[model samples]
Target: MTVRVDQFPEVQGVVSEPPVQARNLSVGEVLGQVTELVQAKKYDEVQALLQNAMGQHPNNGDLINANGYVLTAMKRQSDALRWYRDALEFSPMGSGIWNNLGTAFKHLKFYNVAIACHQRAIALSNNEAFLHHNLGLCYAEVGQHGEAIMAFDRALALQSDFHLARWDRARSYLHLGNYRKGWADYEVRLVSGQIPARSVSGRQWTGTPYAGSRLLVLAEQGFGDTLWALRYLPRVKGLGGELIVECQPALCSLVASLGVADRVVAKGEPLPEADYYCSFCSLPGLFTPDLSLLPAQPYLSKPAEREAKFEPYLRKGAGCLKVGIVWSGSVTFERNAERAISLERLLQSVDFPGVQLYSLQKGSPEQELQGVELRRPIIDLAPELKDFADTAAVVANLDLVIMTDSAVAHLAGGLGVPVWILLGHSAHWLWLLDRADSPWYPSARLFRPRIEGDWDHVLDNLAIELMKLATVKVPLSSVG
Candidate 1:
């Protein structure tokens, strides 16, 4: 649901004046001093100064706008909206006041009204780049990629070096599968001349490999992205380079066997003497000319004893099908709380008439199950298992794996295991709109939200499909 508030316009702002005026001052000029304080990020003094100026002239629009900006900065968004409205009520023609209101609304997630307010601000003041950028963000949120691109273009036209607009436009292009523009925009990650200011004194290596140089590629993001992007390391090695890879402790040995790199080290357990380095993600631009050239090869673990290890885990139960489930991902991730489904909710959705469910989830306090045969309590396989190789052994044994977008999903896909990936509304660009298949993982099927940000409806639909698959008749020989 979208909220409603005023839109802020981009402004070719006038340089703010000093807070203390020397000339004989009117109430309006005194209020401007308070505004100058707000502009300079001196919020603590704004209240007293504004009150003193208001005592002289009780209802000034500029003061109200300045006060509203202070409230917005403090995260009092709803309160800030009220002040902006009051400012507008006092002086309807004030373009800056209207622009401030629009920004408050945009912050509150009121996309449609934010668009209208920004447009109103633009009408009042025709040449503001910020207003265009704000409007573009709202348009992109509502799936108007074409309009969003045009708005970003207008913002850039006004200010040629606007980094924020460039970044947003690149993301919009990526969401629409316009990879050339997306990767081009993504290059800013390297060239911006600002890597994280972490202590890289001993660890960091610039990309200047010499003969027999051992280049180290470090995994920097979440598990799924690290696993998925690791597929490209072979190409990086093929560029006549020696390689060492640093990965999360859990994934170190699993990655080492992929045959792409010479050595693999775990996190926090350092140096193997490498001459150059890059992030796991940045390899894309170096390896593939475009998204079309994405090799899509499966580089993963398939233990020689995979079948033997799994055989003991599965007992001959009454269920016709044995399904494995993963309901959560890394809790520290930004959208993890939203994307993660409750174990209760997941169990409720899947029909278990003739199916046995096994938990394939990672992390602490693994799954809990009730009402099932061969139940020796819900086995918390995560602690006992080590890395993706162990996870692969279990998945290879299961008839199917149903999971959310997590590291397990990537592992399953990489192992050439067929899976149903349950996705949230407004998912990552890779999922796209209303499609059951992905170019990234041909072995996977996508089950996405029917409406924006709605998971219950999506899960209900998934449950229906799971029931059908469980009950479908097949020969006994085919079960193996």
Candidate 2:
């Protein structure tokens, strides 16, 4: 077969052209074009070109590599793996090809194989910080925190300015209950990087002496995270500083009750004048040790109306024990579906004689209270809940709160109330591994799932504990 080459008269160059009725270009040329197309996010073109190239050069390493990348982009991970392996056979020196294989394996939950491939990539190209970071991610996913931290450390050693490795190392440390290190690493979120979606830009933070300075601290992330991190506010206040806390609208009124801040405003509202700014979540990182010496009791300002209206509903009978139940957690969270149990399961297992079950649950769980033996029939207090303070008022009235790891749990723990938190097998980083109590929340008790995605066992254990509480007889003064 004769290949026709076209000569450019003006440029004085010869370019490869489809010879009269020719099929296509060489495999390398096709792969090169496909690489460009994929980089440009032209997935359809990349797929078409790769498919055509594969027809001619099915065993070509470059073509297979391009095909693997395209398949990965299309999320056809399994198909991508076969191509990546085939490409590896031809170009064993290519670290990128190995890394792509590792990524595909990682997505498929093949952790062991992914780790091997990533390690091979690292051995091939030790200078590539991304490969080390990617390996760190895979290690973390597979519950190998030590290795993950080491990989992150390697990545940091290679590039000191890499914020992502810093974040990953801190997260791994936090997961392992290395709070001293975790909190220190968590400071990376405050500086320049991927800013969260908020309009709090242009606010300056002057870490100058707090004498007569007003600091505006904005809330970030989930409800529970904000509530848990707000414990350091008293320290900030003790520094002769006034604070303006801007939080979610729902939290403003409740947070105001804490009395730590001079002013509490909902996010996106008008801001008060301040000499410094910080995020509410960064509190623990800045408020150094002696955490045990620090008070864990609730600091929320009690709302007058909430205390009046909800107190009567929590009337404790002479013989009956009052317990607040929260079986299901928020579905919006990724791990919630696995962690939260069905209300039916809770109702079936809970056996507490002379125990009055009340619903302190707000929002979505309000509908599930139908036909249940709730003391006050679950009420929708979402509208009335001005902040965590109102919720705290309700929790303060209850003898104990049994809840999934949600905002309520944090609120209860922050209030110095006894709270049993039901956690998923792969629970949040704060829970740590194999322990009942949380250092962050002294009053919080963690009950983790024995098996992955198993909540039935957790409920059974909770029911047994509740039954024990029901039979116990304690003096009136000792109850609180």
- Candidate-wise lDDT, in order: 0.70, 0.71
The backbone clash count of each candidate, in order, is 9, 5
Which candidate's lDDT is highest? 2
Worst 10 residues of 2 by lDDT: 4-13
How far residue 448's Cα lies from its native spot in candidate 1, in Å, is 2.2
After superposition, candidate 1 runs with Cα above 4 Å error: 1-58, 62-80, 91-100, 191-211, 269-273, 289-291, 303-313, 316-320, 362-379, 472-480
Which numbered prediction scores highest in TM-score against the true structure?
A: 2
The sequence of per-residue lDDT tens digits that candidate 2 reaches over residues 1-480 is 111111101010112333222248776466445544644678887677778768877777767776776777667889988988898898888777787788889878788999998888878874677678889988887678999999999988988887878888988998886778887777787663534745444345533457777788888878887887777778777777677888888777777776778888888788775677888777766664334554546654446667986755655433566667776666776556666776667766554566776666666765776656543344334555555667777787777788887888888887777888888766778777778888777778888777665777787888888888885566799876
Error of 1 at 282 (Å): 1.6
Model 1 per-residue lDDT tens digits across residues 260-379: 778888878866655666777666656554567777656665664545655655764335577778988877776786678877677777646667677887664153433333422344
Any residue pairs clashing in model 1, and if so which? 6-101, 6-102, 7-101, 7-102, 8-99, 8-102, 8-103, 9-99, 10-131
- Cα RMSDs, all models: 6.5, 8.7
Q: TM-score for all predictions?
A: 0.76, 0.77
